[model samples]
Target: MKKIQFILSFLLVGLLIACNSDGKNNSASSAAEIVVADKVLQNGTIETMNPDQPTAEAVAMKDGKIVFVGSNNNVKDFVGDNTEVIDLGGKYVTPGFIDAHTHVIASSFTTSGVNVQAAQSIDEMLAIIKEYSDKNPDLKVVQAVSYRPAALGRNPSAADLDKLGLDKPVVALGNSSHDGVFNTVALKLAKIDNNVKDNVPGVVYWERDASGNITGAAIETQWMQTYVDIGAWIPEIMVPETMNYMQGYLASQGVTSVLVPGVITPNFGISSEATRQDFEDIMKILTTRIESGEAKMRINTMPFMKLLDADPDDYVPFAVRMREKYNNDMLRVNSLKMHADGHYNDRAMSMSEPYNKDEGDDLPYLAPLAMSADVIHATIMKATSENINVVLHADGTRVIQTATNSIIASKKAYPEATTRHRMDHISFINPETAAQIMEYNIPLNATPIFTNAVENGKDGEAVLKKYSKETVERTMGLYMEMAQNGANVSLGGDPPGSVVEEAYPVWLFQQAMTLEQPGRPELGAFPQNRKPYTIDDALKSMTVNAAWQLQMEDKIGSIEVGKYADFAVFNKSLRDIKPENLVEEAKCVGTMLYGEYTHNDGM
Candidate 1:
């Protein structure tokens, strides 16, 4: 039905253009030069996100662009006999939400596998895995995603997985998306045993039992390689289908645009080999969707490069080539993403101070930087010199500091460069670092859902048992603080790992405003500061600021004349809802992109 509507909308717009372009109908041309709208939405509360026209009651769209934005009385000029006038009945409308950083291809890989996120304990998880295997008796390796370490009493072990009574390998990806537990059969397939050497030693290695025997749990690069080697990922033949589902799901959440900062490649390590090919495959899928009018949202991707020691010359050109080749309205490549550190769990994040020391643990130490500052600076200089935006994933403060220094140096070296470097996951940035990030005009792409303490009320949670209370209060969520401090901040789910639900714009809005888990105010907003984002700023993060991050501020971020007719309609005004009731009261009912409804429940 959506496809049919999209096709009809395009055909109708094309017919209008054809009829108007030739000026063959003198009678129509001379009749007051009236401009006809393809569609007019009136009698609704609309937030344009445009400073000039902050609020409106109606809008008119033509040729996939907003032709009129004003009150209902003024919109009649564009309403013709043929225009599809939708009486909004006082519903609320805003610029379609833009997720500054998200994963489509990477999320597709995870969704192709079994999902065990709903299981609260090991026994229940085992039941799910057994049930999945039973349903697909001929499946090769069983791979499950969203395994919650907190919900389960402890990480499932290979020995525990033996109870499934299957000879096949089973791997459960941790919710962090950085680690996984491999059953013994998987270990045997990967030849990982007592003598298997660790990758990068402590930072990326397998868990071990007494006497140094491999315990089947792996972190960082090893588990990723294991999953790849055992063919646990989705087959290449199914990628297109998976990508479509992910795209449609995001559209249902009111998202019209997304910036996929990084996607996990097949090689799965800190190097640039095969990354371009991986991106090419993803682009092929998106290209097909756009050609067939099956694309629900516009995508801008940044090819991920994990340059540990490789020269910038090896990888920066690939990003440039991608930009030169795929510069279109629907899909484009503009940045090169790099990883600077790992997640904070297991003491992998490079922090200024060691995590809270636990008994029977190895001596506390800061995790070594994945890429030294010099290498990072050189990479940024080269990439920025080529006019490519460099997005650094820096979670820990120390890594954020390093990335900031590099960005500052790059900015100084090329002061006139128009590129916008991003600090992804600004998960734990201190005051000084935050100031530098704000001062340099660096953009921060934040994932608010991961900061909820109540939802993560399990063992190994970042704020609990790892960092000190003072640290949590001072540096944890500077989302609003940075925005208040003149930083360009945008919100995203960083999904498939950071977020369980894809359609969560309302949820993200709630988390950004209240900083508390949904329906669980008892958790008391984890950061301890309890600082909430202002309503306007929170809405901007989802709209205008996010459009700036995409480098499409002039095109589709807001509802304005000459801009794309993209909007998200909600059942109620987000402004009227209390911060705590946002999740319960507000919901996205329709998402329109380029004057076509991609998702419409009832609008």
Candidate 2:
């Protein structure tokens, strides 16, 4: 997380070379002239996101690498007869956005099924399921994704899905991908019932009614991953095609690179030969697309280490093998994703304080699956030793502090390591832990949209009712402190785990700035005492800090002379627009990757 200074001394060197070109009359000087660009963009408001030379009027590129970055007048020297010159006419541009933490496979898989994200209640969800089932009679299992649990009014049961009147099994996954409800037919097929014991008891298990009957809800990955296995049986759920569609979708959204916390192949905690083959097949297709110039977004994928119980020896070497196999600019494998704790809605998160509301269990607090701090430290050390970055899925105050300490210990033990370790979905943290994370230079990735109380329905009310306002005020506004301290902070959409529309980088930025839900400003921002983040802080989190988290800062984060020609073009500069109006006013008109237009909306 150390600041990476991009030296502009190259600009002076280029000026010297251009100075030699002044003697145009000499016959022998033609061959010795400075190299011309393959493409040039001029007359634009370019925000480079680099501390030095933050703005530029023009940029020149050759062979996909930036050749020159300066004024339009100076860029003329790089214009040749074959160079394609784009007159920006004062369009606003920034380094193409990077999603530091996401689940491409899970998001892509969602595209293959029915989406009930807009359903307002259980009845409406049933209606959507009925319509989809009627349309796809040939399909054996009807799988749906992005259903919001909050909109359902209450915990969903098989009886709710039974209202669809479908004989085939039906499955509807939650937007967070943490909870799922299956129809009775589906339950029978998966062999889940009241007799089935919980994987981790309270933290991960089937939802049951007072009569001890299975409500058909599976919480967390223990049984929720059964959806993936069921989806595999459906022919329409094609991995290769769905992945391509997702890549294009991301490019259209102006996302040039993504760091997938976990690839689709391996079901969580279940790494088998078949899953490995699935991974290899997907990687082959991705590498082929990149080689064929068809893939626009760069991907940095990581293998999901066994959640809550990752053995360093098992996961670290597997991560190294993956890194060895996919060694390319377009596709990379350099990180291992470890789930450190459960989510808040399930009352499964390991928190420092007890929840006011309980799930009838005698225990007041839930412990993370990675129970031992020693185990976390050991895993971090192993990953760091192998030069593999670790992305910990840490939520709740206690686990966040634990994860931070483990990372700090690893860094202390291996001072020379540069793995770019990070923790994502950092929902809660105290000032002391935040200071340690900043001092340790640990990159923090936050999905700000998740913090919006209005969007989270009554869960926000539950938070207020469960904890004291003083606790919320102290821990909830940790990001503002980190931004003020100039810590390496990055943002991600975390699709399948977020509302699809609210997960885009632009909306994410808006959330970061206001910490309020769109269209429902009446609720106001949560933790009202906290000041909102500035536009610059949000932009840096999306661009440069994101690149640093991916360890690709030198190559693509900023619009520098030596960086790749990657940019996101907007109709209006983000700085000129209101935070709430960003999604509408600051539309991404074009997306450029490596000097070519990946998505062009006539810009």
Candidate 3:
């Protein structure tokens, strides 16, 4: 258990505003000089990923793009006379949803903590840390963050430290980096007694009794971090007034593009270490919180290559000093992430075979969590020859065939960064090796369960430990049977990793067709591959194949003519709703993004 070395930290994010096409906020770091307007709204319904399949209604916008989508009297010569019209009372629109992968400061630093995600036991998560330690009794402790000891089948002892008998100190978070839950007076202010043993590497150690002790569980088995030199709830979100309640919780979940997998390294282990907030302290706290307007969504990020004592040619001068110092497309960096394996209940997922909960097939595998698989395939063939963007995180099936054979041997030993290499949390690969993913159609991103599906009242053979229930119904619709034998899927939710926001695509499209949950009706999500995805193939795996897996599908997934008006007005009709009121009729009351009005949703 000695391989937690994956230290590759570097941070710098400064300028980068760009979003014009009318959604405003364009610091014009690049791409601009576009102006074309005339008789717009010529037509609508244009989610055109065009392999032929169209007609949502008709779309057309002006100067800000999408001047015509077809037939509302075709773009009246780009609709001038200061063109501006409205007519979607015919509702139903698409083309604004592309969350390929997540974590983005673990779902935007969960709007700075203490939300025990609707607490479900541990006495409703110690009554949300006893009402935030009875409302700041001298602040000193209490940490909430992210929690889930397999959604409470247990883990959080020193007798769940008698609910802070006020020795003041409690910590929680384990929507898995493979478990965490301090309490023992924060394990004696992190002194962690009795042969402390945490040879670290993402983390894992439930191992109990016979005197080897340590049964308050714990996990990392590959990426288990838990530190607290104590910034200690940094006064419940170091307020400039907690950044407008985390930008009104991402404009009430319309979430106009965000990535932030994690960074601000140094003690990049989830908490403390010479405390560095890395990435140049997240570009001096997001370009000084976007000049005090406290910037709301659109921020992109992917820093975390930490392989312990660093230096493997520090990731192309740390992603060319974060894209020549905070490029654009909203604070860009292009990707590096890497983890290769961990989670799926920390049997450390590198499994090709053997976890029938370990017995017989000689019980082994687990531990590709970080390091030596030829040093994680020579750091994904050295960040695919430094064009950066590698991503990794493969949850089992021989770490998705050693991450699809180290990204087809790092794009055939570097044929110039072929530009796509993701793989993250790919829950259960191997349906006859998914016809080797058409070699590398360059985009294989998979999240649909919007990343975690957290109403997890637990069951899927009690949350995966070596799986069952016929291996979670034969790996639940492996993303709509590999996007109906086409692949290239993307869509994200991750938020607090599972609480697929108010209407999570209708309880995860009925748990991807009955993998089960939502008035139980007898459990299914994939009862023997139930496979049923059509709401136009789950709205083209969440809009034009998740905006062509972030190549940004010709300016934000189709609304078309010129594109980028970012939408979602839904009052109903995702083809006449009802997969039982399509989770209260697909909500989004209003959510424009590029056309502004960033989310009204009636809240």
User: How far in Å is the alpha carbon of 129 misplaced in model 1?
Assistant: 3.0
Cα RMSD, model 1: 8.3
TM-score of each: 0.90, 0.90, 0.33
Give, for candidate 2, the lowest lDDT window spanning 10 residues.
22-31
> lDDT tens string, model 1, 384-473?
899899888888889899888988888899989888888887778888888778777888888876666644552215356678777766
C-alpha RMSD in Å of predicted model 3 compared with the true structure: 24.5
Top lDDT hit: 1
RMSD of each: 8.3, 6.2, 24.5
**After superposition, which runs of candidate 1 have C-alpha atoms over 4 Å from their true positions?**
1-34, 134-136, 307-310, 359-363, 454-462, 499-503, 519-524
- Residue-level lDDT tens digits of model 3 in 1-603: 233332221111111112222222221122232224532332334445444335534555544455445445433433446655655665555655555554444233323447565555678787787788888777666666556554555555556645568786666656532445666666666666667665553333544445766655556521233343434434224433333554445445444565555452324544322222355665667667666654655566666654454334665457667767776654667666666556655565565654555443444544555444666677677777777666666656677777677778778888866467767557777665556755566456554442233423344534555555554555534655777667876545554455334324445554454444445444334234446566666667656776655556677765654566666666555677656456555665656655655667541
lDDT score of model 3? 0.54
Task: Estimate the TM-score for candidate 1.
Answer: 0.90
Cα displacement (angstroms), candidate 1, residue 349, comes to 1.0
lDDT of 2 by residue, 139-209 (tens): 87787777765556555788888888788878777767777788888887777767887766667778788
- The TM-score that candidate 3 achieves is 0.33
Give, for candidate 3, the lowest lDDT window spanning 10 residues.
8-17
Q: What's model 1's overall lDDT?
A: 0.77
